[model samples]
Target: MPDAIDVSATPSDLTLVQDEQQRTKSRELSRAPFEAPPAIPGYDLLHRLGEGSFGAVWLAREKRTGKQVAIKFYTRGQGVDWSLLSREVEKLAVLYTSRNIVGLLDVGWDHEPPYFVMEYLENGSLASRLKEGPLSASHAVRITRSVAEALVHAHGAGILHCDLKPANVLIDGNMDARLGDFGQSRLVTEMSPALGTLYFMAPEQARLDGIPDARWDVYALGALLFHMLTGAPPFRTPEAEAKLAQARTIEERLVVYQQVLEASPAPTAHRTQSGVDWRLADIVDRCLERDPQKRVANAQIVLDMLEARDNARAKRPLMVVGALGPVLFLVALYWIASTVGPRIVRTAEHELLQQALAGDAVSARILASSIETEVRIRQDELVDTADWTYVRQMIRDSHQRTKDELSQLNKGNFPDAELQLAFDKVTNHIKVLEQRLAQADRTLDESWFICDAQGRQIYRFPDAGKSLSESFHWRDYFHGRGEELDESVPHDKVSPRTKTGVSLAYLSTSSSKYKVSFATPVWDEDQKTVLGVMARGVHITDLLDQWEPQIGKEGRPDDRFLSLLETRGNRPHLLDHLRIEEALKRVGTQERGEVILRVSPAVEKALETTDRLEDYRDPIAQLDPKFDGPWLAAFYPVGNTGWTAVVQERRNLTLEPLGQMQGVLTRGALSAFLVFSVLLGVLWYFLHRASL
Candidate 1:
């Protein structure tokens, strides 16, 4: 049977609430006693299926055919609008042949209580099924599409179901939609007004003078779909219902309805529902657009869109594969040819460079150890000379002389002949030691000097011809390994002497070259008291001269070089002899001749705390902006000498093979891509011609 208007349906407005209460009152008055069954020729009345204010629907069976049907009896003069009934019957008659519409049988207009018969759909209405919960997206969309197809057929017949809702949509025995309840139906050409259910009604249709429009049905369809998917009509909230009840007049209620829908946030629950996607969501959103101009034009277009959506879903997998095929193939090519191949070459090249750098670091360590040994030997020579019996006796005999005689000798006065003769013997012994030290190593050109206990230099090699003119008190070698060795301390404060001390590197006053002194304290025979200090100096150039032949050797590239840095004072200073010599040769002795060269800040930062080799940029490389360095370098500290040895090599030579391999990989990828494209093009050309 066609669905009865659900008396249980929630009322929308203050007027509808009063109308529903009145209908409830009338239903009680017209139950079976007040309402009489009209006798028909071949049908027997079964029972009252449902009742409304104007009429009641009863279940009946044709006696001869034994077929069930629903009869809606319009009670005469019970506020029945005969024109509305006429319009509804006319619309149904036009859509009689449509399978999606409920079949209308017979109508008796002149009967005491006029009635009409409709096919009995035993499964009831969509609204009854929806009371359980929201339907799944698949089920909901399927039902929505079926209803839309019915609308398309109706619209073609110039009919609009203005009151479309779940209750109006009947589910037949086969569970297929059969649109019915066209009480508010209008022909497309009619200007008469129709108001659908609240929240489902379009804003334009809520106006008192609203005219019939197809978009009104579009909005109802969206609301119907939304209800199926989310279990409630969009904007039909408890709060909205309460506000709607507050409106006293039908005009006020209609205005409030429009306001509630327009002001509320658009419905989005369907978007997050289990099986809903953007495509379906978009269709519902378009149909529900508040502005009719923006809404989907008609139900036919809605049906067409739904069909397209279904077609798209069916073809999605094929489309995905077709779109992603080339991208996946290119990714494979990059993995095999570009990434793995070049990475292998780079990794192998990196390992080889590390091995070579490690070997270089070892070589630097060896050179540093050799320098330490040589310095130690020189210190031992000085200690041995200081321990000489004749040298100690001469110092003792000189100290024994009167203070007046010592002062007079220093002032060049021969106050005592014996003291003068003792000074001469000490001077002669110093000259002999100086000659022996010079012959021992030709690099030792700086004079060896002897300082008395008072820190006065009484003798110098080759004799500067001045007696006791210089004081050696403010020297790090003179003091011990403590803070006083800085050479900035007062000369009067004598520090405890070291066994053997190497002074900080300083520029030679005479030769204008960097030199360092090795000193040992001379002692009395009992070794209880220090008599004086004896020291010899060697030029930095002489110390680094050992590397002269090693620099730029046959296998050593010119870009690779070694350097020495004095790791004392405020910052590390370059003491490389090769660098100093080059500068000297360029300037020809006009420069101050300081061996140390300050490095760039970047290089100094790298050298600040590192004690081992690492990748290094040549400090001087920044002098020329064009140099791309990234040199591999090793730094080894020369033992206890306050100097670091550096061995550096250009990195490009080591990575040259890797660079070539990368180039080959890049070219190969491009070539493979081009060939693949060409092959595809040729294959497509042949296939095209074959199809023709």
Candidate 2:
């Protein structure tokens, strides 16, 4: 081992060759309280400032420089190991020139009270500041970084601040940390064990025979930082203290301390504290590792990591700006392209709409004419049935007989044979009318019937024997008007609202299909007075079949289709394509009967304006509950009837070229974006490699 002697000082005064027991006894004897500050030559002691186990520190002034300094005096008594004082002074002298270390002014070994002077710091120590409470993260980190720098200097000088803690760190006038009080400092080659504060010492260093290592200071630095952040040391919980109190000897207590740190979970309160980021927490955790080898190698590496953290923080704002600039530019370009593309699409859409409307108008007119022709043929046939002499005679005879039978029925008398003969005659007459109606070229009539002038059915072909209620007076066929009466009118007051009529379409409960009746009044021999009425009934689905094929099929909104509208009343009503298809399926089959058509606001608005609509939009396509999209629509009147034919073609299908253009533009933009992304990625990869 190298001799513990400094050549600059006297050999007897500077040499420290004492053993461990003698040094312990010297520290005990040096703690003797002094009654007054001891005077030292070349330095005037002002007053006693603080005291430690080995010495008392006093405020003093240099006579030559008039500079205030702190002097630490070791109490001289019998059996004192003067080597203890020499060893501390030797370590301090080696680090005196460092900015992070306290400067040693002079040493007075032969004085009555052996003393050494150091530069006086007005700001005191970190332990005094810690009494107020935990510091802010920024303040704590700054202090910690300064202390770490001081450790870097001390470690480089082969001296370990084994007792490093807040009390050992003095703050200068500038508020920077200067590590002081190296009384327990050990050189790298020293084999003697040194003890440090309990909670701040590493587990491996918490032993009586522990040798001084750089890791011990590393652990103490972490504990110091932990104290500054949380206002308390790590693993200083009540349970740990309870176990520590049970140990009787220093060796046992040290063993308990090691076991407590090893058994307890790592400290995390620092991590959860406000402003304590993961990077700082990680540094503390690595330094406080239970395994000495796992701890940070030295304080210099901790200083470097803190610098790296600062560098990362400094680049954060620039990184955000670099990323946002390109993203915003691409967004602006995309917005401009979208605006221009839609305008071009709308321009082509307007021209296509005009052509589609013109074509639909022609189709509507043709379909209306065809429906009118078919309806007129059926109406003529109905008029011919009413013109038959026997038809008129039979209706008058049957109405008279029904009135007489009803009179008898009121009196509780059974209908007579004469009433039975009258019904048979009307039945034969209806059968002949049915044959006549069947002979028509486009015979779509479902049934034929005769009614009394009072609107009571006398007979009906196909279901002549079915007994119906006396509720026929309110039927549209009997009154020659599309609307029904709330109550029946008297036989004497019964009159036709129209001479010949095509009644509004109605849901037939038995068939589940809509039916419309064409009726003509049967007159007396003079052809001036009405006797009764003759009518033919036809399902609405049959008429739809005639015009539906002339338009397109019922599929998507874009498919063309024909809608027959009744625009005579408070609102127009049209048969839904889906409903019409359902009715067509039951034409010759049995199914649940339909009750009524629910009025749709879209259908009403579309057909309400006029019997002849030109260049109109299909409101049902645009505003219906499903929002099917716009269509080019045209309406044409079916003869003099209140019915109108609406023909429509989807506008999107008509302007298909616009969709193709948009698709091409979309593909081009996506391809460009992909290429730009690939190029940017390649550039970034090259730049990253070059930087490495």
State model 2's lDDT.
0.68
lDDT of every model, 2 decimals: 0.71, 0.68
Residues 1-692, candidate 2: write the lDDT tens digits. 01111112121111122345755775676556566655677888787777544456778888988999988776543455565558768988998778888888788888766777788988887777787889888888898898898888887787887877777778888988888877678875464677777787788677666656777898999999999999888998888888877875566677888888988999998998888888889988988888763567678778867887788778788667646555554564578577866775776676456545644654566577677877887788678767877677556555655544543432335356554455455456556655774575344567777777777766566554442325466667777656755664565554654488888676665565678888888888787787777788888767667457536743453367787767665466554453354434544434322222323465456555643332344434322434255556777888787887778665666667678877987898888677657766777798799999
Candidate 1 residue lDDT tens string, 1-692: 32344656666611121234545565565564437567866789888877655577788898889999888887633554477556666778889999998889988778768888888888878888888999999888888988898898998776788888887888888888889878788765555577777877988898776757778899989999999999998888888889888986667888999899888999898888998888899999999999764577678667767877898899888657644465555566768675686666766776657655654554466567656777877788778878876566556655555545555564446556765665566566666765785786535547776677766665566434443445557665666552225445565677437477777776666776777888898988787988888788778778766554443434553555667777766556666634564454444445543332565556667776664444565544433332345777777887787888877766787577677877886898799788767766776788799999
Give me the runs in candidate 1 sitting further than 4 Å from their true place: 1-5, 13-36, 327-692
Task: Give the local distance difference test score of model 1.
Answer: 0.71
Report the error of model 2 at residue 374, Å.
99
- Look at candidate 2 and give me any clashing residue pairs: none
What TM-score does candidate 2 get on C-alpha atoms? 0.44
TM-score of each: 0.46, 0.44
Superposition error at 475 for model 1 (Å): 99
